[model samples]
Target: MKQARSFDELRALSGNWLSREALPAWIENGYDQRLELFHERLSFSAQPLSDLPRRLMVQCRQLYVLAQLTCRGMRDDRALIAQTWESVKRYFYRPALSHRWAFSIDPDGDVADPRCDTYTLAFLLFTLAWLYRVQPNQDYLDRVDEVLTLLDGPLAASSHGLIDAVPRPDGFLRQNPHMHLLEAFLELHESTGRADYLDRACALHALFSSRMLWRAQEALPELHDDDWQPARPDDNWYEPGHHFEWVWLLRRLSKATGIDVDQDVRLLLSRAIAEGIDAEGFAIERVGIHNQSAWNSRRLWGTCEYLKACAAEAEAAPSESEAWRSRANSALAAIHDHFLQTAYHGLWNDRLDADGSRLSADVPASSLYHLVLAIMECERVFGRVVPPSRPEPGRMRALFLDRDGVINVDTGYPRKPADITFVEGAMEAIQQAQTYGYRVVVVSNQSAIARAYATEAEVMQLHSWMAKQLEAQGAVVDAWYHCPFHHEAQNPVYLHPDHFDRKPNPGMILRAAQDLNIDLTRSQMIGDNPSDVEAARRAGVSGHLFTGGNLALFAREVLMPRPISEASK
Candidate 1:
């Protein structure tokens, strides 16, 4: 096994200017074009960006849709979300007069091609399903129904039950489309609680594992010909992004079905890091058999996806999955030091080398949300403190909670410092957790960063004042993680997509986990929103959905269930 690299090694090789030179290009160029295609109003074309072909285009859209859905779920960004949804309808939906103006015909419609490929349809449906869940619009639901109807019509899957590319007579089912469809169907299943969606998702999962995944080689086959055979193993090497997507889905499926695909999952995940990842945690887009320049390619989206995967695996398998946890942390740190800029407070596009010596400098528009979600997931897995609801037997890691609405007063996205008010028992609940001897950590998601209503630094100032007030009452927060990304707001540095440091994205929790070396699975998380609960779940943490209680009372009820201290073996 390759040992993880140290920070010193990274610094020595890249020199000091690596981040300065490479970050700007990555930020300006990476994921934005795709974001503009899906979310922003484009004066350019009705079709989606043509730079990538149809298959990759659909995959990119699906990835973006997933990111947007997660963002909407975490925070309340309804107005701009609605505007973006309208554009999605115009571009991807049917029954409109422009429906006849297919992308393949004149290259002037929503997607680049007038002809709707099976991959395109699947991802489009997936996006529609997520939008429906968030906004609950009848129009969006109806559109989803219509698309499903057409999907049943022309784009039938092969006997293997995999959706076939409509125009192609090939049996080749690509992993990218199948993965999104699985996610889309899983979302539908969750929203509607239908067995059919779950069943379909399961079948797609099986198809991907049996056919698309190469077990012997421990890698994923990127492309295939008409037959379900590998067209080019060397050419088919993919980055860790797709691998991580699969890992997350597989873990979720394992929990849902009580069946484990862990062995296959590990093989694919390890191969991704070992093969695709270079020494300094830079995930190369493409790699050749030997160190050949012909396949020397790199991109930013790949790195973003890899981090998400790492965060996901860390949550799902942190205990027995040391390799995954360590590498994931290493990759995240690399991204932070290299791609993340102090100037923009967001990630750069891509890197020039494995050591992250050359910053690609441009940030891809699509990468903003992807990076945000990644961090949230990471924090969810890593951040949490024990509450007073459960009494600790001994000295334990106590979860320090900020006593706003989190412990009590639900002011609903407190905009002003004047709006700061305490909920009853909030302080007592935290004190209870502390009384039980748990090491306390505080995790909170603040959207004011996006609103430009306040700076994160200012929020910190308010939090510091609040902490003093809490300490006066015998409730002390040990450490705090506050997220400041607001897509709608107008801040130069704090606005837009960010890394894992944000809540609802687990950067803060994960950082706490690393800094404190707390056993996350044994840890506890308490937050006001379902996002907090999800973050806890993502972190493999036991979490409580709380409101209006004494911190001690809640702690006694919640944290007492599990033993606070584990015997060191």
Candidate 2:
């Protein structure tokens, strides 16, 4: 058997593939330029299935994806996005139904399903939230308010917090709608910072924890009673995809509320990974509480959820970050091998049989939302830009400086704010570099925390004081990165050999580059230590040794009419 790649490796591979291959493929086949909307489905050969109705939900999803791409600097399709928005408003929204959008419409501009459901409306809210974020519009906000009013008035059940689909009850209360509603509310809260949106999301989250999740098996059911209890028996049916989805959502909720739900997150992820994933590495559609297969079908969205959960868990749990990342890699590999098509670059096999054979040949537009979100998460985790920028990307050039020796006078683990002293002309050097369009970032190795000489808090305080001093000099540091670990430390908690984030490993530099959008090739690291030089080398950036000299003179020499690499050489 071949050895599997790590999570970081997998994230890079899948993220690159999505950006380089899948996104363009989507634009070519999935989107219909003539219709000014995404097609309902695409055949395996990347041809649109025009026979199907264009769903309002699908339209909203594609809009959201496109808006997200635009925000991430992936695509510049604002004209198309604006055109699609007009198409949606002109065709889908019904003035008679109090501005409620129809569920689906035929390509001939006729309504297919006019009944407005909470599911479709939730997606609308989600899309509008992104649209508002991309281009803030009072019109989108008004639409959000109108929909919320409709949901609260005519569509709401007599029972508080329960919403029935307009025109009639569906006879089945599904948790899926509520999940999306939570997602929408979260997005709205993030965009507008309205306390009400967050409050609404909190209520739904409370319901999810109290009623939707089966206490006995810790499984979230697909169907629920009108009272929000599980409709099925404990061993009857459960969705692995929902489990992963909930894991990501719950983590988001916890982050927003500052509530500690780490245990629940861990349990959900553990159960889903153990029971939900089949031998082929696909996230199976439905599984019983006992980990038995119920519905053996696998969907692309499920794997996307799985990848998201893995990324979330990896971020939350540092001790097991590698393991979670590895699981994420496995899921991505499965997606690439099974779901992605070789002939059609961006198209995916939406459904697969238990034996890993393709079941659905049509690429649904809704799945694009899932794929884009997963790719974003991957970029966030791996610190890479999705859909790499072209034609002079907007990444900044950085000057990474070590704090102890390069910025402040090194008096051996100086942690007190009073012990800070700038090197000769350091302030002028930083100002001059900033004037020349370079982001000045400080990367420091603080082993004193591990050695018990100083606490991390004290180190941060010192940095803050240093920043204030620099601000007085009209120079500012863009970011500060520090590694507080040692291979051989008396503190067991801080002891770790070959710590990737410590100096010489380039973890700090790499992370800074990712977070700050710094171009490593054009960046440079200045330090008095060999470890700093090695870190710069590993990060693929040039390194300059700082001896006792005027810092402003060095800055001019380094930033002269030559490549930093050549000048350094």
Question: Cα lDDT for residue 79, model 2?
Answer: 80
lDDT of each: 0.55, 0.77
Q: CA lDDT of 299 in candidate 2? A: 94
lDDT accuracy of residue 226 in candidate 1? 44
For 1-569, candidate 2 gives per-residue lDDT tens digits of 43454444344445556656777777777777766778888777878898788889999998998787665545556787899999999889878765468888887878888887888889999999989977789999999999898778876755445564777665556778888989999889877778899999998888777777777777777766677666666446778898898888887777667767776676676667778887767799988775465688899999999988888887666668668767877788888777875576777889989887888857787887898888777656543211121122246898888888788888999988778778998999899888888888888988887787876657766776787788778887876767666887665445666565688878778766645668788988888899899989988899988886788788777765677887699
TM-score each candidate: 0.58, 0.70
* Model 2 vs. true fold: TM: 0.70
RMSD (Å) per prediction = 12.5, 12.3
lDDT tens string, model 1, 1-569? 43444322222122212222322333233224443333221111122233432223333353444434343333233554455455444554444433332332212344555555656566566666656655566775566666566556656554454455545545465677677777778766655556777887888778777777777667677666545566665555554667877877786676556667888678877767667777767677664422322233445566666766765676565454456556666766666666654453333535455444554543334454455455545544433322212222222454635334675376766655677776666667667766766667777766665566765446656666666677789886666556655445464443345334454566456555543445665778877677777667765677777765555566677766544465232
Question: Which candidate tops lDDT?
Answer: 2
Q: Give model 1's TM-score versus the native structure.
A: 0.58
